[model samples]
Target: MSRVLVVDDEAGLRRALAINLSARGWDVTAAPDGATALEAAASTHPDVVLLDLGLPDLDGLDVIAGLRGWTDVPIIVLTARTSSADTVDALDAGADDYVTKPFAMDVLLARLRAAVRRGAAGEGGAPEVVEAGALRVDLARRTVTRHGEPVKLTPTEWHLLQVLVTRAGRLVTQTELLKEVWGPAYGRETNYLRVYVAQLRRKLEEAPAQPRHLITEPGMGYRFEL
Candidate 1:
């Protein structure tokens, strides 16, 4: 059975998640605040964590950092904040994924399963490298380089680029990119894509304002052109 630590201040949400997940065969542990969440995480050592950003004790990003300090366990942020800045902040703080508030149960479950699958995939994989123009992505190494020069990317930027480059020359729909990179609760978060895509263009494109590789389809989605 996979262990999951669900951290949210809302008693109703915690109970609902625990009951639903437990029914699905997950060993669910619930925490009402950041302190308890951290304690549960340290002791329970769950395979995944569903954390809320609005905690009474510690900010959700801090909890993410704390976990990252010792464990590679996947951390998914569950928050009501719809701002792209908040989403980026969570991802930059080491969160593997983010889910917005009032999310559907089935969507959240799918995200959890995806996170687990990714964690497993990372453990045993040969390097898969994708190239576009002068940019190179080492999928296994999770590193990107432009013109043989290493480019620093935040976790969010790397994930966005990873999805695009892996599907080079294909038009990746906005919803597909959001759900794949952020979480299932993010299909409509277009601003998140805008911010991260611009960041990626700045890092990987020779001309960000007039990008040649990362092409935007405007109202449709984006495509990676080699």
Candidate 2:
């Protein structure tokens, strides 16, 4: 069975998540604040972490940064703040995926399963090749080519691109990408997404300033048009 840590300041929520996850076959642990959540993250090493950004003590983003320094555990952030900036900030910080308040448990659980399964598999770990339009991605080689010419990509940038390409045409949430790519410690670094996305555009797109293939969803995350 997989271990899951649910971190939120609300006691009721913690209990609900613990009970619900337990019922679903996860070995669940709950924490009430960011500090304890970090401690539990290190100690419990949950396969996936469901994080709440509105902690009573430390800022969730800062905690996420701290966790990113050490571990690559999968992190899924929960927030009541629906601002694009909030989502972006959390994603940049290292969160794998983000969920808004008033979320449906069924949807959340589906997302949880996706995160767990993807995390365990490790995004971009495939040694297979992916071909999209003029783009050529060698998963085994971890290389990108356009129009038969090789393109250089940083480790992080390639990982980000892999996330977008794998979910081509789908609106992959900022949280899911962050958690899957950066790990569990980054549940609040949303700004990081813009930076890396910009990097990807610069490298992959013919016109970085006005991208055609990499499209943005206004207040949501980006998508690689297939």
Candidate 3:
């Protein structure tokens, strides 16, 4: 049985989710605000979190950060915010997936299952270090160094880099990168790829204008050449 923490302020929706998830054999815990959500997360230690961005007490992004400060548990944002900026902000804050409100219960369940699977698989068996030129990424420690100095990256940037570096010397299609980093809800968000890739180049490449490691594939995709 997988434990899931569902955070939302709506009484009806919260009760409905608890009932639905429990009926589906999930050990469900519900929180009506960000503070209780954080407390539930710490005490219950759920396998995945379904968080609403519009909490009564604290912004959902802060809750995401709070959980991230101590755990690597998968977080899936459920919100009414439909803008691309909101999507990017949630992902950058360490959310594993984002599902807009008024969503189908089945689709949400599928995403929940996927998040649980990814979390389980991420527990072990990844290369500890990946090196390219002056860049060194410690996958195990989730840290990066360039020219023997730390390279700061947002959660989304690191996720994008990890997806590419783990498959070094190959072109990662924009759709694939978006889905892998942002979640299955993303595919055609090519601008996301462009922005984060540029950020990675600025930090990892000797010259961001003339990059050696991160290469664009025009209409195809991008590649990380070791």
Top candidate by TM-score? 2
lDDT of 1 by residue, 1-226 (tens): 8899999999999999999999998999999998898899999998889999999989888888889889988888898986756656676567767677899999899888877766665567523987778988899899988999999999888888888876554456677789899898887889999999998888888999999999996665787776
How much lDDT does each candidate structure score?
A: 0.83, 0.81, 0.86
Ranking by lDDT: 3, 1, 2
For model 2 the TM-score comes to 0.66
Candidate whose lDDT is highest? 3
Question: Candidate 2: misplaced stretches above 4 Å?
Answer: 130-163, 166-217, 223-226
Off by over 4 Å in 3: 127-226
Clashes of 1: 0
Report the C-alpha displacement of residue 13, candidate 3, in angstroms. 0.5
| Residues forming the 10-long window of minimal summed lDDT in candidate 3 | 166-175
Candidate closer to the true structure by lDDT (higher is better), 1 or 3? 3
Please list all clashing residue pairs in model 1, or write none if there are none: none
Q: Is candidate 2 or candidate 3 better by TM-score?
A: 2
